[model samples]
Target: MNKKPNILLIYTGGTIGMIRDFKTGALKAFDFKNLLEKIPELQLLDCNIDTVSFNEPIDSSNMKPEYWVQMAEIIEDNYTLFDGFVILHGSDTMSYSASALSFMLENLAKPVIFTGSQLPIGDLRTDAKENLITSIQIASKQENHKPLIKEVCLYFEYKLYRGNRTTKINAEHFQAFASLNYPDLAESGVHLKINKEYLFRSSLNKNLIVRKNLDSNIAIIKIFPGISPQVFQSIFNIKNLKAVIIETYGAGNCTTEAWFINLITQTIKKGIHIINITQCSGGSVIMGHYETSRELIKAGVISGKDITTEAAIAKTMYLLGQNISGKSFKTIYETSLRGEIT
Candidate 1:
């Protein structure tokens, strides 16, 4: 007889956890301890569900590294007890948290699915029920007695995306995120379909390792026409800055102006690693592909190559926390580990 999967639902706060009061029309947190009463559909799944909520639920805008650490700790503490985890988080910072967690949890052998909805769970036409239900189902999915997904992923609307590869592109629509460079791991429709070819394969021999320390001394500089030297110099002057992400033009092209080139070169020389990513939504950064980008290559800027800004920031923090030397930081940034970059 097959044992039903045990899935843990971590409610970290968001629209999906909200229930509207009919009398006041104000939304408030719904206790997940009684989740089955709120969403009876959960009873249909052949899985044992458990719930954990933050002591104090926070708005997504208030999300920080400390919250991420807490989430990781929860997963690590319950790593062996649960077959999978489904995180209910706000859409605003969901991508960032998901991306950071992807790097923090190493050698993951079970699914960690993040999801949220656009409306309160109590609303008659709310999307919360479906999003939450599907997320839990995906987390519990198994084949041949082995978990199908073994990585951190975001299941929003109807698509499953590599957590680090996703970016929140919509504020009001049901589809809140898009993985521009990578393909979807699964798509829900009349039937729940898994794109097995796109799913990450994990090594059964390696145990999951959680990284708790994250260096937050990083900044992003989006290059723009008519950007002044003073503005550029100010960002480079941030005291004790560890890394900077330069959002460049097409294919990582930036101003070939002497002042801009010299500024970046000087920053690189100062041991501040600069990563050059394309500002375009869906394209890889090809350093030296054009005259405009030639000087960036000469200046020793690392190509971000289709990585979203959210993932780039998380990767920088993760690598910086490792205290890697300046000589190897560029190499690590350019390499793809969690499919964050092409």
Candidate 2:
């Protein structure tokens, strides 16, 4: 008989990690040591489950590069002991965290599934149970004694998405996340469905390389009808700013005004990488597709292609952390390293 996969459940704090106390009538952090007691269905999975909680769990809103490093360290330290990891996180910033992890855990050959819920674990109508249970199942799935999943992913509302491709699109609904530019990697329904073709596979021979030094010296500027030169000058003039992601209009199009083009050209000349990504959530940024975006192309703005803004930020930080040369930054950013861009 085959030995069951060992799964590590990391509770990083979120609505899913809270339970209602009947006596006090207030939500409190659920004791993950009693996880099996809270959700006995986990007992039915064909895996050995273990639990780890943050010393002081934090809301996803408070998640930062340091927290991401903590998560990566946990995975690195126990990588040999666990076949997979399932993180319980908040829905609000889950995509950002997930995207950051995808870049941090380089050459990852095991599943790192991030999941959360629109409701608390103790709620009568909680979606947490299903999400948590199915994520573990997906993570533990094996073929010929090897793990089935080989990359970081996000599981929510029965859909499995490539972590970096996902974005939180809804706050008040059960389906809080969406991967608009990419197809679902897997789905959970009557039977858990794995779209094998869509899955990201890594080489087995290479060891996992954890990237801890993520540079957060980046800013995002969204173009609006009346965005002034003063506003643009202030942002570009920020001290030690490494990169800026411009959320331009449709297909990476922006104003053709001389001042706007000159500012972007000057910024790129000063060694600060300027990335052009579309403001629309569902489409790729086709730079220079129209006359409006031509100046951006001429000014040497790197195109983000189909990358989500969250992923763009994470990717930029990760690349900058590597001390990638200014000459190679644009070339590398336009290339998809973690399948983040199509």
Candidate 3:
């Protein structure tokens, strides 16, 4: 007989982890120790469950690399004991955190599902119960006596998305996230239907590697009309800046003005990597497709392809931390490392 998979629920703080006092009507963090009592339906699941939480719950806006490291450490410490992990994080920065973890937890061969709700768990019409419950169920799913999902993912509303490919698109709706360039890995309705072909299956031969060294010496230059040379130049002057992500216009096109081109050229020559990514929410950056962007190609700017800004930042920081440099950095940055791009 197959043993029930052990699932670990890591509450890192978010609306989903809160409950209203009912009498005082004040919101407070929900105690995961009594998770079963609060959400008794969890007992119906086939898996054994456990819970862990941050020492002090933080608002997702305050999320940092250190918190990412803490999350990775929790997963590492319990990697052998649990078959899967579910992280409850604030929706505002959930994509960024999920993207960072996708790169940090190398050779991941089990599901790390991130999820949260638009409303508190104690609200009259809260979405937390459904999201949290389904996430745990997804984490416990198995095939051939092995985990069915083997990569980082985010579940919200009824859609499951590759973590690195997702972006929070709505602020006041139940469907708070989307994967513009990738398909949903699974969906919940009458039945839980998983798109098996879209699942990421890493090779199981290698050991799970938790990379803690993440460099944050990076900046973003979101190109806009009326942006001045002085402003752009000042970003390059930030101390110890190692890389910059330029959110370029459609297809990675930018100003053809000589001043703009020269500044980009100079930045690249200084060994500061510049990545050209599309500002459009749903398309890939086709560098050199237009005359305006040709100079960027000539200046050796890295292409972010279809990666989201959140993933771009995470990927750049992860690579920079690994001490990858020169042409090697550009090459790897342009390539998809965690199913983040096409």
Candidate 4:
């Protein structure tokens, strides 16, 4: 028989890690050392689990590349000793964190499942236990003795989505996340069904690589009606700005006026990368689909295709930090590096 898989639970602070003091109705972080005591159901799983948490956990809003680097290093240090990893992060910025990690971890051959709850684990009606439980179950999934789910993924509300493709769409519902362009990788039902065809199978022959450097000198420009040239120019001219994700209207369109194109063209000449992403959650950016967007393409605006704004920003930072510049930078940025774009 095959040995039980060793799963690592990296708790980076989120609602899922808290427990309530029922008497006072207060909540606090649970002791991971007594994980079984907190969640006895874990002992029933068909794998062994070990957990590591951040020394001083912060809300996901405070999550940055430095924390991302620390996460990568933790996984790298324990790569061989574990079979899969489940990250507990705040859902508020989970997509960005997941997308960042997807880029930082290259040729990942094991699952890096990120999950969190909309409500505290200690709350009687909390969604934490199910999300946490199912995530661990998915992390332990295997086939013919080889582990399944060899990529960054987000699990919540009975669905597993590609990490970089996910976006937290709802604040109150249990189904808080969505992967608009990509199909669900797995779903939790009576059987925990996995769409085998959709799982990303990397070449195990390639050793895992962690990218540490990330550039934060980026901004996002969301185009709106009657946006003044002064306002647009201010954002575009931010000091040392390396990249910008322009959230255009439907189908990657924007103002067709000559002045807009001139500003875009000038920015491109100055070595600033501008990515065109649709504001709509469900459609790909077909730059030349409309007269409005065609000028952007001509002005050297890179297409984000079907990627989300969160993924776009994270990817822009990642590519910029790599020192990839000019046409080569655009080419690489336009390509789907982490299955982020469909």
Candidate 5:
């Protein structure tokens, strides 16, 4: 018989870790050490599970680069000891965390799944239990004693999505996320069916390497109708800004106005990397394909292709951390690093 997989459950803080006080109707942190007590269903899985919680739980809104580094460190420290890892985090920024981790962990050969619940676990009708249980199952899945998934993924609402391609689309619904440009990695229904063709195939000989340095000195500028040149210039001219993600119109088209083109050109000349991504959810960025976007391409803006905004930001930070030059940075940004873009 094959040895059962060892799964690490890292609870960073979210509704999944909460339990309601019946009398006071207050939600409090449930001790994960007694995981079985809260979710006895976990014992049903054919794997050994261990739990870890942050010393101080944080809301997703406060998640930062330092936290991403800490998460990477934890996985790095425990890389060889476990078969897979499931992170319980707030859904508000789960995509950002998952996307950041995708870039941080290179040559990953085991599943690193992030999951969280929209409702508290203590609630009778909460989605927490299913999300948590399935995430663990997907992480522990193996074929020929090798991990079935070898990349960062997010499991929610019976669907497993590529971490970097996902975006949180709803706050009230259980289906809070959608991978606008990528297909679902796996879906849970009568049985857990993985789209093996879509799975990331890592170079088996490569050892896992964790990237620690991340540049948070980046900004996102979303273009809108009647946007003022002063406002655009102010953002583009931020001091020490290393990168900017310009959310452009459909098919990566933007204003053909002279001032806008001048600002972009000047920004690029100053060594500030600019990435042009689509504002629409379901399309790829096609820079220079349209007359409106011709100026942006001429101004040296990098095309983000089909990358989600979350992934674009993470990719920029990852590339900036490498300290590459402007010309090379654009080349790397346009390429697919971890299935974040086409």
Candidate 6:
């Protein structure tokens, strides 16, 4: 007989956890102790659901690296007891949190699906139940007694996106997140479908290692027309700054002006890694394709390709935490480490 998969639902606070008080019509935290009753559909799945909630619920806007480390600790502590994990988080920072977790959980051999809803769980029109239900189903999916997805992923609005590849696109829509550069790993419809070709392949021999230390001394500078020298210098002058993400114009194009080019050169010389990422939503950074961007390539700016700003920040923090410096830093950042970039 096949043993039912044991899935752990980590509720870190969000709209998904909110339930309504029938008397007052106001929302309150859904009691996870009665989660099975709140969403009875879960009983139909061939899995055992256990839950763990944060001691104090936090708005996603206030989420920080400490919270991320706390999450990693929870997963690491329960690694051997659960076959898969589902996290209920706020949509505002879901992509960032998910992206951070993807890098933090190294060589994962089981699914970690992050999900949330746009409306309170108690609302009749809420999307929470479906999201919560499907996330567990995806987490529990296995083949030949082995897990199907072995990476951190965000499942929102019926699509399973690589956590690092996703970006929140809309604030009010049901489909708030999108993976513009990379394809969806799976999609839910009349039938939940898995795109096997897009899933992250893992080595069964490797153990999952969680990295808790994250360096936060970084900044993202968006290049704009008429950007003054004072403004540019102010960012570069940030004390102990290790890296910066330069949000260049389309195709990584930036002003070829001497002041701007010189700043890039000076920043690189100071050992601050400058990554040139396009401000455009769906295109890769082709640094040397244009005359304007050629100087950036010459100035030793690392092309961010199609990686989202959220992932860039998270990846930079993770790499910086590991003290990965010198020449190889650019090589590692440019390479597609967690399928975040093309």
**Per-candidate alpha-carbon RMSD to the true structure:** 0.8, 0.7, 0.7, 1.0, 0.8, 1.0
| Residue range 1-342, candidate 6, lDDT tens digits | 999899999999988989888899888888887998878899999999999999998789889999999999999999999999999999999999999999899889999999999999989889898899999999999999878999999999899999999999998999999999889999999999999999998767998899998999999988788889998899999999999998989899988888889988998999999988888888889988989889988789988899899998999999999988668888999887777887
Candidate 6, run of 10 with poorest lDDT:
333-342
* Model 4, span 110-213: residue lDDT tens: 99999999888878798998999999999999877767989999999999999999999999999999998999999998998999898877766999999988
Q: What lDDT does the true structure give each of the candidates?
A: 0.91, 0.94, 0.95, 0.90, 0.92, 0.91
Candidate 6 — what's its lDDT? 0.91
Candidate 5 lDDT score at position 282: 88
Runs in model 3 with CA error above 4 Å? none
lDDT by residue for model 5 over 1-342, one digit each (tens)?
Answer: 889999999989988889899999999998999998878999999999999889998888899999999899889999999999999999999999999999999999999999999999989899999999999999999999989999999999999999999999999999999997888999999999999999988778799999988998999989999999999788877888988899999999988888889888998898888899999988999987889998887789999998999999888998999998878898888888898888
TM-score of each: 0.99, 0.99, 0.99, 0.98, 0.99, 0.98
Clashing pairs in 5: none
The candidate 3 region of ten consecutive residues with least summed lDDT is 198-207
* Candidate 5 TM-score versus the reference: 0.99
Q: Cα miss at 333, model 1 (Å)?
A: 1.2
Candidate 1 — which residues are off by over 4 angstroms?
Answer: none
The lDDT of model 1 is: 0.91
TM-score quality measure for candidate 1 = 0.99
Model 2 misplaced regions, further than 4 Å? none
10 residues in a row with least lDDT, candidate 4: 196-205
Tens digits of per-residue lDDT, candidate 3, 1-342, equal 879999999999999999999999899989999999989999999999999999999999999999999999999999999999999999999999999999999999999999999999989999999999999999999999889999999999999999999999999999999999999999999999999999987877899999999999999988899899998889999999999999999999989999998988998999999999999999999987899889999999999999999999999999999998688999999888889989
Candidate 2, 138-165: lDDT as tens digits? 9999988989999999999999999999
Question: Clashes per prediction?
Answer: 0, 0, 0, 0, 0, 0
lDDT of 1 at 288: 85
* Greater-lDDT candidate between 2 and 6: 2
